[model samples]
Target: MKKYHFIAALLFCSILLQAQERYFLNSDTRLYTSTSTSAEFLGYFKYGAEVQLLSKNENGWYKVKADNLSEGYVPEKFVGTRLNAADIKTVDNENPVLAGGDQYYGGNHLFVLVAGLKARALPDKTSKIKEILFTGDPVPVNYLPKNQDEWVNIGGNFDYENAKFTLRKFIGKRPDFNTLIKEFDKLNPDAIAERKTVAERIVELAWNSDYSKLAPAYQRYSEVVKQLNDPKLIADTELNVSIAKGLDKHKLPEQIVAFTQKTEFILKGIKTKSLFLTQKELVKTFGKPAKTASIGDECGVYLSDLFYYYPDLEVSVDEKQNKAEIVKVFINENNKMILNANSVLDNTITEKAFIEKYGTYITASIKAPHSYSLQFEDSEFRIEFKDGKLFFIEIFFYC
Candidate 1:
């Protein structure tokens, strides 16, 4: 008798909660078997497809039934009130499947102004997180809903609220801040010096341009400045620091390892057995690095990796393979590493001697304000000359 009463109560609630008004899918949306994003995916509903609204959960997932009697859950953001195809705005050449009709309607660019913004698999808050985006990250906008401004469909992923952002409608090329950040990361000398230069440039730009009105934008800008000013250092153990100090005192090997396609070579009295030396071997030879840093976004999806800094060398390790693949030797005031048999790195080697020894390179260009880089064809080695002398020598795995 109690079980029957419970079943009756559920039926009564379901009938009361059922939506009477019609609703349509605002974008190409996926249907989940359950309310959770981890549930089985039923299928996708085309843009502007009419769906029967069942019930909406507290977390904004809508229980809906498709025309074919396919009952599943779709994000509430995707379900809109009676959408008309003609009323939607669109641009040419956008994907028809992702947009309404043959056009995409939205700003030309979507600039993320906040840090740690999570990209969702669906527009709803309960959807699976695809990636974490940072400040200045330009999200690729594929389609924007005309009815609501709550969520945006970027490629396939979605960002919540769309509050901490700005949109631009220009067709011309714009300054890519993210690319500039990547270039700033690749700057020579050290992370501290590189960040100092970048931070100063950011301040100059911010001061010159019109400031954002949003409070969150101001907060994010402050955070970026703070991060650049106070760069995080790799927490090295005391024993590791001691080992690095001891390794620096030793006299480096005098042999010149030709900067060729060969992976195995002796560098600074330490021998590399393969394209990448294991962390164990690196620690044994050069000791653990003083600071470890990343070159790109924290998610590291595209052009991103880590660099471990020792006393006079920067070691870039491949995260996938867990080995030190790229080694950069910085020739400082003390002349840390000698290169090419007798060529010293302390701004004393002549250009004629460099050309006579290494021969002509495939390309030579100015890399920085006062630095020049030379790259050889069919080789993984690159040499940067500062003050008309060899400054930085880098070698990495070709692949």
Candidate 2:
């Protein structure tokens, strides 16, 4: 009875151990103090040694507790299931499977079309050429295994040499070959799906001129409509096919064209009128006149009478108040052509030339002995006189 009890206890322990998953330490594998190859190598465990899985590290190493009470890390690839004989037979009978689909063999070069041929980096289809021979550019190809199509088998390695040979023919003198290869390597499942979605939308919008109905799929009607109205889309056969045959009957195409034209016109107008006004314009419209001085040179101040409210007086100069005022004036001196009082006839006078020829129109009442200040529309001009002859004129304007 004692021997039977001991045997029963041993059997129970064995069953409990078998219920837990076990890992076997294999050869050519060095155990690390931590779950990283850079960690100190403790030692190598012989093939078929038993280990219990504790946890996994992000670096593809597994931490395992050994039968000797030792703990170490080993590469996950070198660890095998410690299955029983029956389990091994079952696994051997079942063929190991891998996912396979369209495989990107690395070393393939990409050529962008430019001009009339494929160039290194432009978007003209006719100008681009692929390097395929010694006389041609040597291109490299990289495989993107993660971007495999549905039919592709996973876990399959690519023949890098063959891929390179195949892509060399497509490489031209274009220096973008390496960049294209790197991009190909970075291709993943998510990115491919996103690209497909965008391409599909583009095709759909190009075919259907009525983007108003496509609002659910596209957020910005104006932007998507503009893209659909692009000249390139109009020329695309896929876009034409995707669009409804009755698009012309609906007049959506014409509307899109008109809208695009209007938008372009508005943008161009804004650009053209960007530099029309400054703060100086406002100042000129409503600014006070500076002080001035009168020289005894019979100097007469001319103000524009066009915008002026006073129209009764031809020209009046008050020396006592030092104020030169004009009444019944349709044009202000800033807008009048005031030549030398002695040189030209008064009949040749015009409001447009007065401001252009003469300085500011308003002469202020405040004056010095030889100098006087005047206010033009928005500018202030200082007039200096020597013996009643106009000596100097200065005007200041700001941005």
Candidate 3:
């Protein structure tokens, strides 16, 4: 008889959850433009507000429509077919979920930002402490204040040992419970200790091998050292110092700094020297180019031809009859160039040093991950940086 009652209750719940039914927002819910948490937010629906359930997706997001004809998506866990009146709590106006009522309606998922935060029985700082929350701990939104305080009600009997902050329900993916906790446990003392042990093991291996001779071993060491110096883990100064000292004994080759002398490059000033030489002069100085390309109506009015050297140099030229005067120059890596006597414009220069030397640039654009192109106040000169170091440069001239 009890089994039959249980089955009947399940069927009743399913019927209530059918699409097109009137559903109530279980928590402060957000209507996103799409199913992703990272998508543009349309608006928020207050808790217990009625919404029309259009449908649900495989990822557990509900297609919902509000009374105002506004339609968007909300997470499956943030809505319900029926409301439990007992779940409602009194509103406090002093602290909001986020400051200044900026809290969205559907902020059902949140992660701990600080190291130690207290979970309370009520939405007040003076409320009874249920438990302590730690950094990176993912918590389900229980009740957000409709009044005005930052305090959140996490409910009673939160099982921290067996908590499952599954991403599928939250972020629509899997890291499993154990793995997710490990990721959240970044600041956990044991986890930090484990990382330190692994880093030390890598250092020991790098020390044993002839890093200078084996390129692969040296590359591995360089990667490990980079991670060891990561900002988040830099707090471990003793380990960092010890590992750095161990690796410094190797004394690998350093980048050769070129073009140390200062030379003024006045962008708006008169052109005293030309970056590009005439076709006749180019061949005379560097012999015949490795390749040549003709540019006409298809390219643009300005560029007539391009001359490429054996390696990292390209020269654009304008031709009339048998003579072609250089119009632009592009160079990459290992070049003799000076932005001013104080700053060396070369591949070996770091991005910080470049900016410090040049003051400010007009426009900056992302070329790729960790790569950027910066154009100064003068459009004729464009510089590109990759991996935080100078990558290439382009200088344009009409002559």
Who wins the TM-score comparison? 3
1 versus 2: better lDDT goes to: 1
Task: Tell me how far the alpha carbon of residue 161 in candidate 2 is from the true structure, in angstroms, after superposition.
Answer: 54
Error of 1 at 165 (Å): 27
Query: Which RMSD values do the candidates have, in order?
Result: 17.4, 31.0, 18.0
lDDT of each: 0.46, 0.33, 0.43
Q: Per-residue lDDT of 1-399 in model 3, one digit per residue for the tens?
A: 565455335334433554335577666666678998799765545565556676755498988754323467878876777879665533324222322122322333444443235664432345446565443344554323221222332331122222222211111111133333344345444454454443333333332323222233233334444555675334333333332333344322221112211222222121213343455554565567787776553535344554444345565655453344333333344354554445556557765555444422222211122232333222245566665666666554323
lDDT tens readout by residue for model 1, 285-309: 7777899897764543322377878
Ranking 2 against 3 by TM-score, winner: 3
lDDT of 2 at 270: 21
Which residue pairs of candidate 1 clash? none
Predicted structure 2, TM vs. truth: 0.17
